[model samples]
Target: MEAVYIDKHYGLVAECKQGSKKACYELYRLYSKAMLNVAYRIVGNIEEAEDVLQESFVDAFAKLKDFRQETTFGLWLKQIVVNRAINLLRKRRLDLTELEDGHLENIVDKEEDDQEEIQYQVAQVKQAIQLLPEGYRIVLSLYLLEGYDHEEIGQILKINENTSRTQFLRAKRKLMEILRQKGNVA
Candidate 1:
């Protein structure tokens, strides 16, 4: 199944490299919605996400000739999208700080029983994530929603790997607190 997907995009990408508009549109049709969702998750706004989606595709298409399938086309495209989303945030004066070994862990409970929790609706979970401070929200979105490991997230966000881990743990606990406030904790 993975091979089939790779094969399909490979052909479209080849055509796109050769300046095929139809092929580019076909590729965009296949991935645009997912791209929009990724952008929205990062930016947390509809208009900015859509703008990022357009810019990402434009940039990706321009650089199509350099794409060697070391990774899947989708993964390559997602990297571009994520970088662009971060850039957009930067344009809005989002300042990413390095934790000075701030001992954030002291506030995070480690007890096993504290992990027990009730199920949250998808909307509620999303709402809670949106309510997070930008740093925590972006780290959580990249690590959990986008499946980036701490090292990868650190590279992407230009922070220490340990900082990414700390941010993720803090985001998890903060999310739980939000859910608890909403009476969703068991």
Candidate 2:
């Protein structure tokens, strides 16, 4: 049974690498829901998330040769979806920075015990993020939700690392304020 599972997994990957459109469709069917979740988290709109998913998959297939199998195929696809979503946010011109220093030394640590609370907090944060200017929203989504560090964010956004860090701080502060206003936080 396990062997059959493994064969289907590896076979799909190999066929995908071989540029089979059928394999691509199979891959999409397997991962599209998860990818859409990630896209919705970042893009904050169902329609936009769908667009990002479509565009990311197209790019992923075109650049499939560059995909090394080191990471699971899902993770690789996630990176592409996140990058495309960020680009879409940027094109909309959202100004994402709400803090000056880009330092969040005092933000509460996220522990396992905080998981439920954090999820609730994230809902509020997402609402706040949607309210941000386009640039700030993009920076915040890439840095916070997508888990790209400052250097990588800078590269993706064509800005310097310091700018990414600053934008992150601003985004955090704005999110906090929004949550507080919504009575989700103190």
Candidate 3:
């Protein structure tokens, strides 16, 4: 069944590449809801999510030629939506900070390996992340929830990799502070 879905997905991409409007519409119908949820997660508003969804499809269609199929079409389209949402957030003058290379290395090294502890931390952290400033919140969402690497985040935000890491660290710190204030931790 999953194989059938994969075949259909690839066929749609091929047809859309061939400029089939029906295929494009089918792709839109298939992915729009999931894409909208992704946009909403980043932008945190229904209206903005709708707008981003439309804009992302437009951008994806426009640049369909560049898509190499190294990953699934859904993943490619999701990246476009995330990039557009981040760009929109930046244009609004959100205060996102960049991290240095050393800092990013430190963070990667410091990440916990224990699954149980990590899950507990992640749950607590997510609650605090919700309280972050808009810039930090969006960055955190893109990096953590959406599984984008710092380099991808940097490209989306027009910053360097270091900046993405720094913002992530700042977001984490701010989240921890918020959690502490709420008495979720010591």
Candidate 4:
């Protein structure tokens, strides 16, 4: 058996490739809000997220000819947005390679214990995520929200795969702590 895929935006992308300004605008309108949210989740700043969104769109359109349509346009654009957001973080000296010693096992133990009964509202979780440290927030957002695996995140952030795993673990532990402190966990 063979697998087939379809993209609803195929016609729009084809028109974009043909330099139809209207198609380009329509594509942008279709994708911008969701892409902006993806960026904001990684960058954790609305303004920077907007900048990443715009840059990703500009880059995507400029390189549209290179896109082979093996995947949906949204997925391709998301890769670009993720890359640009990571680059922006790097410019601000983001480092995911730094190792914190001696406390990870303890965090894991406590996290497991505390997480078993925790319940949180959507808004609370979102607020708590915004309060996380940059490294943790990025790792958590990429892993949990954006559905990137630790190996993929390691490649994206230029860190070891184990490092990405550690970051994710720590991020989860810290997020739980924040939720507890804020009394958002039930």
Candidate 5:
């Protein structure tokens, strides 16, 4: 049996389809902050993330008629936000590609073993994440914070699944390294 998703805000979405300005504003108010954070995680700049948020809302509203209820409105809007943020990053010529497979062969990720031993403050982890390269940060944010699997991340970023896994591992390794260097880990 398929799981049925009952969105509490379905009525508002319906109203939005009918050009109800109040419903539109309500939806925006409900989702904008989370969506902005999503964009910022991928784009790595608050100003650029704001631009992406605004543009995503505009696109979502304009394309509201085409938004079938295959998923919740929030999920749909999130997709738009993520896509727009990624496109903005592309425009800035951010290097997201992984190095050739040969170079990654010897880099074994021991993150799983190390995670149990590390104890760090939330603030330190957040700061360390920010210090990561754009590619690593984006992959890490999407996989860990945004809750996407490597397969989905690969599809979203148009890269190989192995590449996504590699990036995620490298991100975790780098994050731990940063925390250790700062003496934030216990």
Candidate 6:
């Protein structure tokens, strides 16, 4: 539909949909690096991330006709890539445990005015994220980085919404601990 052309990638995407492999490759060239980064953030391994990216593109192209373009092509493709990456972790048996009542109680909720942004550099923060375990890292990536709320993250991860909130809080605590250990956070 002409309305689908609102996204700039739709031009090449349309050509690809019409069986133009060159256009398809061009679109891949445009999106692969960013897509790979998304996969890497979720999977926490370069090789696995690359494999997942390739698989997601294949799946996306195969199901290309079903893409309604309600959102941009990139957003749609990102969902596929993220799902594939999370599936890989599921195969690894990601364990998202519920927090004890005391832990949640001890975790005082801080208002924005009461919170101070950490002083860590971006690279330091990224390193800390990568060092987190699979469950925590995935929750953190989906919630904080990808802009999904706790309910959406719970739906994606097949966990309770409360579990997502607990994992997010734990992930933040772990990330801050890592930064403190690295002497990156004051």
Clashing pairs in 5: none
lDDT of 6: 0.81
TM-scores, each model vs. reference: 0.81, 0.69, 0.69, 0.79, 0.81, 0.78
- In candidate 3, stretches whose alpha carbon ends up further than 4 angstroms from where it belongs are 1-8, 94-128
Off by more than 4 A, model 1: 1-7, 94-120
Q: Which stretches of candidate 5 lie over 4 Å from their true place?
A: 1-5, 94-120
lDDT, candidate 5, equals: 0.82
Q: Model 3 residue 170 lDDT?
A: 96
* Overall local distance difference test of candidate 4: 0.82
For model 4, residues 69-113, the per-residue Cα lDDT tens digits are 778999989999999998999898553332223211121232565
Whole-model lDDT values for every prediction? 0.82, 0.74, 0.76, 0.82, 0.82, 0.81
RMSD per candidate (Å) reads 9.9, 8.9, 10.2, 9.4, 9.6, 9.7
- Model 5 quality (TM-score): 0.81
Candidate 4's C-alpha runs over 4 A off are 1-5, 93-120
Tens digit per residue, CA lDDT, model 1, 1-186: 223335547988998999899999999999998898888888887678789999999999989988888788999999999999998998895432322222111322346554333122555677778778888999999998899999999999999999999999999999999889997665
**Per-residue lDDT of 1-186 in model 3, one digit per residue for the tens?**
133234448888888899999999999999998898788667765667789999999999999888776778998899889888877786775433321222111112335577556565655555466567876787788888788899988877788899889999998898878888877779
Clashing pairs in 4: none
- Candidate 6 lDDT, tens digit per residue, 82-170? 89999998887643332222211112234554333422255457778877877889999988878889998899889999999999999
Rate residue 140 of model 2 by lDDT.
Answer: 80
lDDT of 5 by residue, 1-186 (tens): 545567889999899999999999999999998898798777766667789999999999999998877888898899999999988987886543332222111223346775444422554576688788988888999999899999989999999999999999999999999989999875
Deviation in Å, model 1, residue 34 alpha carbon:
0.7
